[model samples]
Each structure stands twice: as structure tokens, then as C-alpha cells.
Target chain A: MKPGTGPLLRVAGVVPGLWLAGFFLLPLAFVWILSFGEKQGLVAVDIVWTADNYLRALDPLYLGILAKSLWIAALTTVICLATGLPVALGIVFAPPRWRPLLLLLVILPFWTNLLIRTYALIAVLRTRGHVNATLGWASELFGLPFEPLSLLYTNTAVVAGLVYVHLPFMVLPLYATLHRLDRSLVEAAADLGAGHLRVCITIILPLAVPGIVSGSLLVFVPALGSYLTPDLLGGPDSQMIANVIERQFKSANDWPFGSALSFLLMYVTFGALALRSLSVRRPAAR
Target chain B: MTEAVRVGGICKRFGAVTALAEVSLRIEAGEFFALLGPSGCGKSTLLRIMAGLEHPDQGSVFIDGIDVGRTPANRRPVNMVFQSYALFPHMSVRSNVAYGLRVTGTGRAEAHERAEAALGLVRLTGYGERMPHQLSGGESQRVALARALVKRPRVLLLDEPLSALDARLRDEMRLELVTLQKTVGITFIIVTHDQEEALSMADRVAVMETGRIRQVAPPAELYEAPADRFVATFIGQVNLFPATIGADGTAQAHPFPGVTARARGIGAGRQVWIAVRPEKITMAPRGGVPAGRLSGVVEEVVYRGDLSVYLVRCMAGPDGLVRVSRANAARTADRLPGPGTEVVLDWAEDCAVVLAS
Candidate 1:
């Protein structure tokens, strides 16, 4: 309402903010508009609105696929937490000169293409891969029967691949948080007569919760939407929502269904993130 | 009441740099001892060793007559108030103070009782639920002290606990800490680089230098009868002059041509240093007693309200500078000693200490 007030606020903060609104909010609004429209043979009338697409998307078969995707993503996240915490701790406690080297080692795999890394796991877990060959050699040396194990295309392999590809994403943040934790808190716990494990549980773990939660979030949502690892290392039963969306858009030639599936995936990811945001209580910044 | 702590022949080294060298001391049950030193002087290192945070490369440590050399920090009978307080940011003030009790298997009700008592001791009774970040620096420091004292350590160690506070708060906390020690009757070992802090709060001060104890004595004894040149200069502002010992133990100190004094165990022509406190020296008018008198030029005069300090430079032999502070009641606007004014300095022979250089 005032002459110079709006421009002053613009110079202070409002300008860069409106620029983001123009880019991100405008595109999201376009997608929301497209999501509610009806398409018939890819030439539907824009005015004809229907809730049928949403209802059909809730069909048991599609919901079952969504559930499977969520379950696998949750499992992948839990596995990352179990393995990433110690690795993060090790980096945090490392000597000052060695910390940078250890962090670099954890992130070395990320420098290459993610697809390439997942495929590398494919080479190692095949029926006649390095693991089987090593087992065969060991059995022959011990004068026992040798057999090539079947681990190439399975859910276990897919989960393993997901963890490997997303591990640095999980570890880097946890390491940053753990490294910044006040070491005196741990010493104080020990002085209070807490044993080693008690110190870790009460002091180290709680302080590191933010990092753990953030690492889980960074890994979980992407793992849920992942199609590459599963498609390469999984069977038909292991196909995730992203694989289904890919199939609908490229192979099925059903534009309306594909658009509906895309919107549904976005909605589910948004809802999960919203729930996560509500659950993890943030510490007040200094 | 306990015997408190005994540290015997503790030595520590970080690679080639020896941080603490064979330091030994005993703390009484209820005395407040201070390790006073400049930065890099290993006072904090010794305190950390006593707290079990650092392992002595050689020697043993005991608390309440129990050998705790191989014991972990959690098993020791000592607690420390870190310089930064190190209070858990996620926990409230009450929880932070109760943390040690809770982890040691105390029940919630009992832990809360002790925590409340400790908080009350530090005068923070109603602030239990406030987070550490919400408290002021002084309040947080008090909370840290309460946290350590709540555990009832046989000996409480504080590493520059008041170094983080502003000057006014530091003075207030000094008084509070001394009173708290008396009230609790627990042994307190505080490490500080502040000479005034050491003099004002400690029962006995151990002055450290270059990873070793220079002298350990009462604050008055340490300042009045320093054992060496380092202790004399470090404790307070002093004027030192190079002198030589003569036969019959009478040493002719320079700048005072005929001034001689007794020096023990010194051969003739051996170099020695004479120490004189600024307040101990006096400037007199013309026709003053001529014996034990030194001649110097008044370099500068600075008025500090309560007293005025005159920096005088001796022109002959070993050019030493002496500071003389005159009381404000003796202020004079007439013929004040300006720069380059010839003046005579006189002091009793007992006021000056002669030491081997």
C-alpha cells in the first residue's frame, strides 16, 4: 500500500523469493491443472472434469503395487540406518587428518554414474559371478560339492543395490551431524557413571537423531520412486511404482492413465514427506 | 569428607612437545587450589589428567586414596566443569544437572531430588525446565558448576571456568565460587591464567611455566617471596637489576654505586638479579638519607586516581626501570617529577631480593 515500502522489502528479500515463485510454483500449478483434466484418446475436452481417474487409481491392484513400493523403500531405509550409523560414527571419531580421507572414500562411488554402480553390483551377484566363483574354488579346495548360487534377480539383490547406490547420501549427512556433536557431552555422560554403550545410546544417538532422520528422508523418498535398481536386478513381482509409470507412459500408450499415475506418485511422496516433517522435532537454532 | 586427590609424578607428552612434565601435587579435602599459568603452560593438561580425561604417559593418580590410573573416566571420583560448560543442548537445565545421577542407575525421583538440591545450591531453583541455550552465560556457567557438584566428586576440577564470563560476572562468580567451596566443603582445583583470579580465590596457587611448576605457595608468599626471576616477573609488575656478589656476602647492585647487600652461596663476580616491587620503593625530597640510594630520571608519570605510577630509568650501569606508586592523598601540583627530572630512589635492603641470574 505504501510507495517505497514494497520496493524496499523487494530489495531486502521479496525479489529473490518472487523469482522462485515464478519458476517453481508456476510449474507446479501447471502440473496441478493438468492433473485434474480429462483426456480421451489424448484429445479430450478440457472442460469435462471427472473424479473417475482418482477412484480408479485406488483400485486394489494399483494400491497393492503402491504398498509394495512403500514397503521396499522402508526396508531399504532401515538397512541404510543399521549400516550407515556405525560408518558415520567411525568417520566422526577418526583422527583429524584421516577424517577427510574417510569421507572421500565413502563418497568415491558417487562420483561415477549411479546406473553404472548398480550395474556393477549386477556383475558381482550373477549366477556365475565373482562370489560364486570364489565359493566354488573354496569348495574344491576343501573336497566338497560346488554349486553356483542364484542371486542375480531377486528382492534381496534389489535391496542391496538400493543401499549401495544411496549409501553416501545417507552417510554424508549423518557424519556431518555426528562430527559436530559436542564431544564433552559424551565425556560428561561417562563421568556420570554411564558405561560405553549407555553413553552411545543416551548422548550420541539422541544428538545424532537429526542427522539420522535427514539421512533417512534423503534415502527413502528417492528409493520409493526408484525404477533403475529394481528393473535391473528384480523380477516382474518386484516392479515398483516408477516402473509402472514408465510402462504406462512409454509402452501402454494410455496418456490419461500415465498422467494419473504421475499425479498419484507425486501425491504419495508429498504425503509421506509431510508426515515425516510433522514427526521429527527440530532443535531450536542458536 | 575424603582425603580428596593426590597426583604423583604425572608426565604427559604430545609427540615431541611435552605438555606436562612430571608434575606432582596433593589437594586437601576442602581446600580450593588453583593452577595459575600463562597459555601453553600445561595447567589445563594437568587438570585433564587428574579428571581422567587424559592418561599420564608416566606416573599414577589417586582420588580419595584409591588408585585410578588404569580406570576409565566414568569410574573416577572426579568431575570437571569444562570451559564451554558442554551442557547438552537438547536437555533442560534440570536434566543436564541430573544427567550424571540418572546414568548411574539412580531412580527418577531420587535423581530429581538431588538435581533440585544442586540447582538450589547454585541459586537456579525455578529454572529447571529452561534449555541451556536459553540461559545467559553466567547462568550457564553456574549450571555447569551445579552439574559437576551434583555428582559429589571427591575433587571438583574447573578448567578456566570463569574465562568465558565478562569481567563483572567473573568477579561476582569468583566470590560465589569461594563461598560455594566453603559451603560444600569439597576440594576444588581451578585452572586459570588470570593472576588476580588465582590471588582472590585460591587457598594456594601453583604457578606453572614451560610444562613445569615454577613455585607452589600461598598467594601472598608467591608474590612476596618468588623463588626465581620468572615467578617474580609473571606474578606482578617488578623492577629487576643485574648485580654482582662481592666478598663477605655483600653484593654491589648497579645503579646504586655504593649499595651492597648480602647474597648467600655466591662467589665474587658472579652475576645475580635484584627484584624490587613498585610499591616497596619510595622517592624522597632533597637531603634524604644517602645510603642504599639509586639515581634515575623520571621517564613518565601516570595518574590512576588512587595512586600515581612513575616509571624511572637509571642512567648508570644496567639501565633498569623502576615504578613507584604514590597515594592520591599525597598528590601535589607543584614540582611533580616530569620526564628527564633527576630523582633518587631508596628502599630497605630487606625489600629487595637477590637471585642468581
Candidate 2:
């Protein structure tokens, strides 16, 4: 960390740098090279440069899936923001002794495997699952007729599963920002004749925009490219773009098209992040 | 003068710590008052209570003769400038100043005009476009003041307003605050532990200690005739000598057996302290005429630009050390006493205030 330690610093970076070059960057370079190639047969792809696969991705059928994926991801991000905000605030304002426990609960889900977590969602949302079974028991107790609701294997289920997994991503950053926020500013707002709602809308939200930006990106990107949740919990009509990419590599046997699709999703994510940096860096007064 | 704010029998406790204990004060309108004390002495807590940010456990706060004990801070007719100048960091200085007006539903044009006027009052007219983070510490402080003053409340509370500023800036702001108070003619209640800040600006000061108001008096009275040993020492540097009162309305001073000083309103034969400010004592050479019977060698001399403090160690004993401060007159620039110089210390009968030991 001291000055004139440049050689040591460069040496420290060599291990991770080589790791990335070998495992991550090289594989990504291979994918980029493969994306320009033409599919020869069931197994191999010719090294001929072609834009045909990217052109194929522009088809209306795949476009519709991509659009649906964006909508679902956007909706999931919005819901996460709404729900995670209150939870984060609650944790921040809780007694100091209780805060660690509350934060642990938020992070506890990450310890378990994501695939197993998605399966756990299946038990709660499937037909004759816990929610409907509880409702049906209540109906029987009340002597009212009822039918099991089709809750799982739908777009609604996919959104719910996404929100379930991504809520912590939203809450953690929000919690960090809210925790560092000066409580005196809120008190100052109240002292200056601001009511509770006005203080929140005028003072709290604007200050929290940075956290919301990062949290939304954290939830939206993963939700857009989500594979396990939609694959397991979504119905036949709920095929997201990730599902299409998976089909291209597996049954479709078109590695070039899959690589192109993956890169396309990456481009959208990067574009959103770039746009955010531009707006966040703007120095103009609002 | 009309009463601006009054808190009656206020009592507050935070867990085991008693922040305020049956404290009460009546502040007059258009008067600048101060609550002065050390940190954690409940001055800021009492200010917050008056601002309606805090509620007392067993008391009522009256504003303009109406008991608004239960009113929230937002509903109260008072504003506070915080110690840290808690301006909204996300807002521009203009919006920060106009926040109270805008939030309370003032028209946009009117709010903007009044906010600009407030900014002008603080002498920060063209700095409104800068964000809170963009401004310097003193600028942020003025923005906070402008923010609160724009609301035009009947009472303005400042909690340690100048503590964050450097020495020269604090002196400048003390004068500005006094001038601003007279311009607006609203009651200004400032809380500070700096004796100079409280004494210089406040029309009257309530000196607090350990959650209790020890004395409430004008600046001159608090400085010249302190109510107790604590105020005497806290207001400025003072030399306290333990003594017993004589039957002739004079205190029998210690160590120097021949010295006795007259003090008013104390029973005879009681232990007391003769409290004299360092500036009050005059220094003379050893064996000089009109000097006290006692004499000591100058132990140390601290040279301040305007004045010099001399610590004289009397020949009587260790308990006989007396401190004297003299103004550095131009005539004696070459002859100022240095260390190890033999000298005599003397004070007038009126210089000492007698307090119970």
C-alpha cells in the first residue's frame, strides 16, 4: 500500500490476473471466436465469419421471448425495490443488538444452492401446495366450496421465484446506504416543518437513489439471464431469453447462436450500467 | 417584553442517565439567550425539548402562552440549526434553504424568493446553486442557518452553532449572529459550552451543569459576580484561595496572615473561597510601597500578545501560589517581568467574590 511498492503490487496481481486470463478471459475469447463461425454439422462449427446467427436472433419468435424476459425482469426489480426498502429500513432502525440477526436472515439464503432453493419454491407454489392447501382447509372449515388454484408453472410463479432469490441483493445495498445516512437530516427535515411522507419523498428517496440504482442492477441483470427459476417454475408460455440460449447450445446444437444471444444480453446489461453512470455522474442541479 | 418560550418543570432521563432534571426556563421574545455548559450537560437536550424535538417526562412547554407540549417538531413554531449543520446533501443550497417553505406548501415562486432573501441575509447570495457537499464548512453552516431562518419562526434554536468553525471564524460568526438577531428581532436561543461564545452574544445566559441550571444572569453579572465557585472558574481563569470570614465583613485570607478582604452578605466564622480573576491582581516588585505584606518569586510567565500571566510562588508555602495577569502596556515593553523575578501580588477589596467552600 505504501508508495514505491509498485513491483510488489504488480506481483500481487499476477495470480488473479493469470487465473482470469486462463479460465475466464480465454473462455470468453473462445466464445467470441465461436460466435462468428458457421455451424457445419451436428457437432462441429466451421471457422467461417458469418452474421447469419445474429440475424437469426432478430426473428420475431425469439424477439417476443426476449421482450417477455425484459418485462418479467423489470417487474421483478420493481417488486424487489418496493418490498426490500421497508425490510432494509426496518433492519436499519431496529435496536443495535437486533441488527446483526436481521442482516444474517437476509444473507442466510445465499448459503444454500440456488437450484435447491428453486425446488423449495416448487413445494410452496405448486397446485395442492402449502398455500392452497391452507386455503382449502380454511374453506372446508367455513363450509364454502373451493377449487385448487393453479399457482406454479406460470409466469407469475417465475416472477415470484425471481423476487424471492433477488430480494437480498436489493436489501443489502439499500441497507448500507440507509445505515450511513445521517439521522439528523431526517430530524432536520421534521424540524423544518416536513411531515413523515414529505420527508421520505423529498429527502430520503433522492438520497437513496444511488442505492436503488445498484440494487436494481443487481436484481435485474441476474433476473434477466435467470435459467433455473424459469426452467423449473415457468409454464410452456413463460420461456425467457435464457431458456432460448440454453436450447441453442443443447438440443438446437448451435453454439454460435447461443454465444451471440449471451453476448446480446451482456450488451443490454452493460448499456444500462453505462447509462446509469452517466446520469449519476451528472453535476447539474435538479 | 413578551414571553417567547417557557418550559415548566421539565424532567428527562435516558435509561439510567438523567439528561434533564426538573429544569425550567422562561425566555423573552426578541432576546438572545444561551444555554451554556460542557458536553453531556443537557444544554442541547433542553434546546431540543424547547424545539419540540424532545418531550419531557413530566413537564409542559409553552410557546407564546399556549402549552404545545404534545406538538411535534414539524408542527412547532420554532426551528433549530444542528451542531453538524444537517443540510440535505441531495438538495442544492437553494432547495436546502427553501425546504421548509416548500414542504409546508408555500407557493413555488414565494418559496424561491424567500429562500434567496434568506441566503442574502447570511451573505451567501450567489452560492445557492451549489450543493451541500460542494460548500465549505462555514458555508454549510450559513446554509443551515438560512434554511431555518427562511421559515420565519418565532424562536430560533442553535445547538453549538459555531463549534465546528475555526477560531477566527467563530469570532466573526458570533458578531454576525448578534447582528442577525437584532435585524430579525426574534428570540434566539443558542446552546454552547464555549464561555466566550455564550458571554459575547447572549443577552442573558443560563449556565447549566449536570442537567441543572446553576444560574441565569446577564453576561456582566455572570462574569463579574459569579454565583458559585464553579461559575467563577468556568467563566474564565480565576485563583481561588480558601479562607474564613471575619466578624468585620472581611474574609481572613490564608498563608499571608496580615491580608484580609471585605465581602458582603456572609455570616462570620464560616469557611469560604476568595475568588479573584487573574486580571484583577496587580503585580509589584518585592518590598515596593502599596504592595501586600506577602511576596513571592515569579515562577513562570506566559506571554500572550495583549496580556501576560505570572505565576508567583509565595515564600509562605506551596498553598501560597498566586496567579496575576497584567495587560502589556506599551511603556513597559522592555521591562516585562520574566521567570524567577521577585514580585508582590495585590488586589482591591472589591475584586474578590466570596463563595461558600
Reproduced native contacts, each prediction: 0.71, 0.89
Please report how far candidate 1 places residue A198 from its true position, in Å.
1.7
List the candidates' TM-scores in order.
Answer: 0.90, 0.95
Model 2 has a clash total of: 0
DockQ of 2: 0.78
Compared with the true structure, what per-residue lDDT tens digits does model 2 show for residues B270-301?
A: 88887888898888887646667457899888
Clashing pairs in 1: none
Name the top TM-score candidate: 2
RMSD of 1: 4.0
Tens-digit lDDT track for model 2 on A1-286?
Answer: 7886998889999999999999999999999888888988998998788888778888898888888999999999999999999899899879999999999999999999999999999999888799899999999999999999999999999999999999999999999999999999989999999998888898888888888888998999999999989999999999899999999999999999999888888888888789788777874534
Residue B316 in candidate 2, Cα distance off native in Å: 6.7
On the 0 to 100 scale, the lDDT of residue A59 in model 1 is 91
